[model samples]
Target: MSPLLLVVAAAGGVGAGLRYLVDRLVTPAAGARFPVGILIVNVSGSFALGVLTGLGAAVAPELSLALGAGLLGGYTTFSTVSVETVLLAERRRWRDAALNLFGTLALTAVAAGLGLLLGSAAA
Candidate 1:
């Protein structure tokens, strides 16, 4: 394997591990009514992606690869989010499911914007 791919793989491993730990830690406290763990992960990952993309434009491309492609790519849980949404709908929690779907979109958009704003503001 190439050296660059190795770094990426390591970053992905770390990101996945971190995500699992965080989800486990947060879910028990928040309960089943809300999939708060995945929500937090997705939103945070969105924000980080934004920050990295903004930074890539402002600075180095390599940084974006490390932080955005490596970290956020592994960290985000699109599959899990989709599955959970489906489960909610299957259980006839259509309102909750719809809210989750829309809410994730809205919140991720806001978070990405916020990340860009914050990144641009920083030195």
Candidate 2:
């Protein structure tokens, strides 16, 4: 195994751990009505990815791969979003379900765009 692979794996583990902690911290405050935790994670992860992408050649390829495919990859949770949206729908909370689904998509895109702009300017 390559050293870069090992680094990415370790980063992924750390990202997953951070995701868990963020969920634990946010869920209670946001309440059971919506899956705010996962939404936040996905959005933030997207933004981070955008920044990494925008940085482009400014950052080393290895570092970019490690942060994007490793850390943010582990941090985001599209699967969880799907499950939660389905659960909300099954529970007959159509508004929350739709919001969770569409809201996440919209928010993440915008966040990523903003991050890209910021990162590109810095670069």
Candidate 3:
């Protein structure tokens, strides 16, 4: 395997570990009423990706791939969001479910846009 691929894989493992730690830390404070942990993870990941994208030619392609596709890919998770939404719906918490689904989408998009703008300016 390529050395770059190995770096990305290692970075992904680190990212996943970070995700787990963040969730564990935030979940308790946010409580079981909502999955605030995952929400934070996705939004932050999206923003970081936007920054990398905005950096454009300033960042090397290999570094970008390792951080974007590897680290952030593992850091952010739509699957958890989907499962949580379904679980909320199953419990008949329609409002929370809708909020989780739509809210996350909207928030992450905005975060990414903002990150892009900032990243571009910095670049």
Candidate 4:
């Protein structure tokens, strides 16, 4: 395997482990009513990816790929979010479903923008 692929694979493992730990830490208190764990993961991953993208111009390609394409890619779970939202809608929790859909989009976007700004400033 190529060096970059090895780096990405290792980082992906770390990212997946981190996601599992974060979900375990955050999910139980909220119960199964909503996907709070996934929301947090997605939003945080968005911001992290934004930072990585913003820093790309100033950083090495390998670092950016390892973190952005590998770590954040492994960490974020839009599929889970989508599935949970569908489940919520099926259960007639329209408000919760809408909140999950819009809230994740809005928040992750804002977080990514902020991360970009911060990363740009740092660079």
Q: Pick by TM-score: which candidate is best? A: 3
TM-score of 3: 0.98
Cα-based TM-score, every candidate? 0.91, 0.96, 0.98, 0.93
**lDDT (Cα atoms) of all candidates against the true structure:** 0.83, 0.93, 0.95, 0.90
Compared with the true structure, what per-residue lDDT tens digits does model 1 show for residues 22-121?
Answer: 7888899999887989899989999988777666567566656766777788888888888989999999999989988989999999999988877777
- Badly placed stretches (over 4 Å) of model 3 are none
lDDT per residue for candidate 4 within 1-123, as digits (tens), equals 799999999888888888888888899988978889989999999998888787757988888899888888889888888998999999999999999999999999999999998888888
Candidate 2 lDDT over 1-123, as tens digits, reads 999999999989999999999998999998878899999999999999999888889999999989999999989988999999999999999999999999999999999998899889889
TM-score of 2: 0.96
What is the TM-score (0 to 1) of candidate 1? 0.91
Residue 69 in candidate 3 has what lDDT?
89
How many backbone clashes can be found in candidate 3?
0
User: Candidate 1, which segments miss by more than 4 Å at Cα?
Assistant: 57-59
| Top of the candidates by lDDT | 3
Q: Name the regions of candidate 4 deviating beyond 4 angstroms.
A: none
- The RMSD (Cα, Å) of candidate 2 is 0.8
